[model samples]
Target: MRKTTFLLPIIVIVVAGLMSALFIVDEREKALVLQFGRVVAVKEDPGLAFKIPLIQEVVRYDDRILSRDVEPLEVTPLDDRRLVVDAFARFRIADVTQFRQAVGVGGVATAENRLDSILRAETREVLGSVTSKDILSSDRAALMLRIRNSAIFEARGLGLEIIDVRLKATDLPKQNLEATFERMRAEREREATDERARGHEAAQRVRALADRTVVELVSEAQREAEIIRGEADALRNNIFAEAFGKDPEFFEFYRSLTSYQRALKGSNSSMVMNPDSEFFNYLRSPSGGRAVTPPAPLPQAQVDAAEGAALEAAEADAAAGTAASEAQEEAETDVNNYEVDQVEDAEDGVQN
Candidate 1:
C-alpha cells in the first residue's frame, strides 16, 4: 500500500510534469520555444509541441492576418502642404523564429509595435515625396502599393509580411482646412464673376445685333416708302401733264379753282387784291386767260321792258324841271307888275 501510494504520487507528478512540458500549437498560431530568453525553436503547424519543463517557455502568436491602425499623423509634402493622415495595415507573422529573435518576450505586442513603426516610416517616405493632392487622389492606390512594398521590405527584420498599407483618410490639417476652404471660396467667386462678365458681354453682343438689325429694318422700310412715294409722285405728275397737254385753258381754270379753294380755306380768310388782277382771269372770263366777244343780246321782251322803264324815268325828270322854271317866271312877273303900278300911282299924285 505504501509503495503503491508513493508510485501513484510519483506517476501523477511525472504526468503533470510531462503535461506541463508538452504544448499545443494551433494552425492559427505561431509559437516559439524560448529558453532563458532565447528563441530555440519555432512551431507553425498544428500539433503537440515539447519544451524543457521549467527551463523553456512557449510563446504563441496569431498567424492569421492581423490589422494595425496607425494613429493620425501630420506629414508635409514636397510642395510644403501639410496633411493629416490616418492609416492601417494588414500583416502576418511570416517567420516566427525571426519574430522571436527580433522581439524577445514582448511577443505580438513588440512585433506589432516595430511593424507599425516600419509601416509609418514607409508611409512617410512614400507620401512625403508627393503632394497632398496625389495622396488624396486616385493615385493613392499606387502610392499605397509603394508604401506596402517598402513596408514589406523593412518588415522582414520584424518577421512581418505586409498584406496591404492603406490610408483611411488623407485630409488637410485642421489649421489649413479653413484656409483651403477660403481659397476655394475665393476661386469660386472669381469664376462666378467671370461667368457673369461673360454673360454681360454676350448680352451686350445680342443687344448690339438687335439694334443693328432694327436699324437695317428701319432703313429698308424708309427706302421702300420713299420708292413708293416717288412712284406715286411720278404717276401724279404724268396725269397732271396729260390733262394740261389736252386743254391748257381748262387746266389753268382747274388749277385756279384749286388755288381759290386753298386760299379761301378757312372762315377767317380775307384777301385784298386788284379786281382786274390776272388772278381773277377765270372770274373775268370763263375762258380763263383768253378774251371773248360780248355775249349775245337778251330776248326782245326783256329789252323792251328795260327801255320802257328808262323812258318813264326821263319824262318824270323833265316835268320836274319845267315846273320849277314856271314858278320862277311867275314870281318875277308879279314883282315887276307891282313896281309899275306903284310908279303910275306916284306920277298921278305928282300931277294932282
Candidate 2:
C-alpha cells in the first residue's frame, strides 16, 4: 500500500507538470516563447506546443489582416484651400520576428500610432502639391496610390505590410462651404437672367418678322382680288356687247321700255309736248312720222277707246325720253367727280 500511494502521487505530479509544459495554438495565431521575460522562440502553426513549465511562457499574436482608422487631419492644398481629411488603412504583420523585436508582441496600438504619424506626414506631402480642384476630383486616385506606395515603403522597416490606404472623406470647413455655395448661387442666377434676356430678344425678332409677313400677305391678297374683279367686269361687258350687237333695234326698244317702266310706274308727274314731238307723232300717225288720210267719223264709244290708247302710248314715250336724259346727266356727273378725286390724290402724292 505504501508503494502504491507513492506511485499515485508521482503520477498526479507528472500529469500536472505535463499540463503546465504543454500549450495550444489556434490556426489563426502565432505564439512566441519567452524565457525570463525575453523572447526565445516563435511557433507559427496550429496544434500542440511545448514549453518549460513555469519558467518559459507563450505570447500570442494575431496572424491575420488588421485595420486601423486614422483620426481626421487638416491639409492645405496648392490653391490655399484647407480641408479636413479622414482616412483609414489596412495592414498585416509581414515579418513576425521583426514585428516582435521592433514593436513587441501584442503591440498593435503602438504600430497603429506609428503608422498614423507616417500617414499624416505623407498625406501632407502629397496633398500640399495639389490644388483644391484636383484634390476634390481628378488627382484623388493618383494621390491615394502615391500615399499607399509611400506608406508601404515606410512600413517595411516596421515589419508591416500596408494592404491599402484610402481617404474616406474630404470636407471643407462649414463656414467656407457656406460662402462657396452663395457664390455659386449668384453665378447661376446671373446666367439665368442672361438667358431670359436672350429669349426676350429672340421673341421680339420673331414677332417683328411675323408682323411684316402678315402685312405683305394682306397686300398681295388685295392686289389679287382687284385683278380678279377687273377681269370679271371685262368678261361681263364683252358678253353684253355681243348680245346687244346681234339685235340693235330690239335692244334700243327694250331699253326704252325699261326706262319708261322705271320712270312712270311709281310717278305722278304732269307733261307738256309740242304737236310735232316724236312722242306725239307716234300716237297721231301710225306711218312712222308720215301723215295718214283722214277717215269718216267713228262711233263715239270706239273713238273714245282709240283716243285713250293713243294718250297712254304718248305718255309712256315721253316718260322714257326724260328718264334717258336723266340717266345720261348722272353718268356724266359721276365721271367728273371721279376725275377730280384722282387729280387731288395725285397732287397729294407728289407733295409728299
Candidate 3:
C-alpha cells in the first residue's frame, strides 16, 4: 500500500509536469518560448510545441491580420479648420523577434497602443499639410494612401507591417457647421442672382430683335402697298384718257349722267348749286357742250319711219296725260265731298 501510494503520487506529479511542458500553437497564432523572461524559441507553424516546465513560458500572438480602431482624433488642417477624424488600421507582425524585443510582455495590447500612436501621429502630419477640401475631394484615395505610407514608415520600429490605414469618417465640429452652411447658402444665392440677370438680359435682347423685325416687315408692306396703288391710279388715268380721245362729247355726256345717277340715288339726296352749273350742262342739252357734234343724218326711209313712230308716241302720250288729268279731278272732288260731309256733321252736332 505504501509503494502503491508513492508510485501513484509520482505518476500524478509526472503527469502534471508533462501537462505543463506541452503547449499548442494553432495555425492562427505565433508563439514565443521564454526562459527566465528571455525569449528562447518562436513557433510560427501550427501543432504541438514543448517548453521547459516552471523555467520557460509560452506567449502566443495572433499571426493573422489584425485591426486597430483608433479613437476619434481632432486635427486641424492647413485651412485652419477643426475636424474630428475616426480611423482604423490593418496590420500584422512582420518579425516575431523584433516584435518581442519591441513590445516585451505587454503583447498585442502594447503593440496596438504603439500602432495607434503611430497612426495618430502620421495622420496628423499628413493631414495637417493639406486643406479640408482636399481631404473631402476625389483625391481622398491619394490622401489615404499617403497616410498609410506615412504610418507604415513610423511603425517600422514597432515590428509591424501596416497593411493599410483608412479614415472611417471626417467631420467638422458642430460649432463650425452653421458658418459653413451659411457661406454655402450665400454662394448659391450669388450664382442664382447672376443667372437671373443673364436671363433678363437675354429676354430684353430677344424683345428688341422681335420689335425690330416687326417694324421692318410693316415698313416693307406699306412701301409695297403704295407702289401698287400708284400703278393702279396710272392705269385708271390712261383708260379715261383713251375713252375721251375716242368720243369727247359722248364721254362727257355719259360721265355727267353717271354723276347725276349717283347724286339722285337716295330719297333724301339734295344739293345746293347754281342752276347753270357745269354738272347740269348735259341735262340742259343732251349733246353736252358747245363742242357737241350732232349725230349723222338718217336716210330718208329711216327718217320717215322715225317720224311715224314719233307721231304714234305723241298721240299715246296725249291720251295718257288726259286720263291722268281726269283722275286727278275725280280725286279732288272726292276730297271736297268728304270735307263737306265733315262740316255738315259738325253743324248738326252743334245744333243738337
Q: Per-candidate TM vs. native?
A: 0.66, 0.60, 0.61
> What would you estimate as the lDDT of candidate 2?
0.73
Best by lDDT: 3
**Model 2 C-alpha lDDT per residue in residues 1-352, reported as the tens digit of each score:** 9999999999999999999999998889888889987888888889999999989998888889999888999899998999888999899888777777878754878888898999999988999998879888845788898889988888988889999888999999877999988888777666656655555565556555555555555555545555554555555555546556665644554465565566455464456658676554334645435533343343565455545555555555555555555555555555555545555554444344
Sort all candidates by lDDT, best to worst: 3, 1, 2
Q: Which candidate wins on TM-score?
A: 1
Candidate 2 stretches greater than 4 Å from native:
221-352
The weakest ten consecutive residues by lDDT in model 1 span: 343-352
lDDT of 1 at 262: 84
Residue 219 error for model 1, in Å?
2.6
**lDDT scores in order:** 0.75, 0.73, 0.77
Show how many residue pairs clash in every candidate, following the order shown.
Answer: 0, 0, 0
Measured by TM-score, how close is model 2 to the native structure? 0.60
Better of 1 and 3 by TM-score: 1
- Please provide, for model 1 over 1-352, each residue's C-alpha lDDT reduced to its tens digit, 9 standing for 90 to 100: 8899789989999999999999999979988888888888888889998998999998888989999998888888889998888999999888888877788778888887887778778888888999877887876789989989887878888888889888898888888889998898777666656655555565556555555555555555555555655555565565557646666666666688888888887884788989988887878776666854343444566455545545554554555455445544554555455545555554444344
Regions more than 4 Å wrong, model 1: 1-8, 133-137, 140-142, 152-154, 245-250, 265-352
Candidate 1 Cα deviation (angstroms), residue 225: 3.2
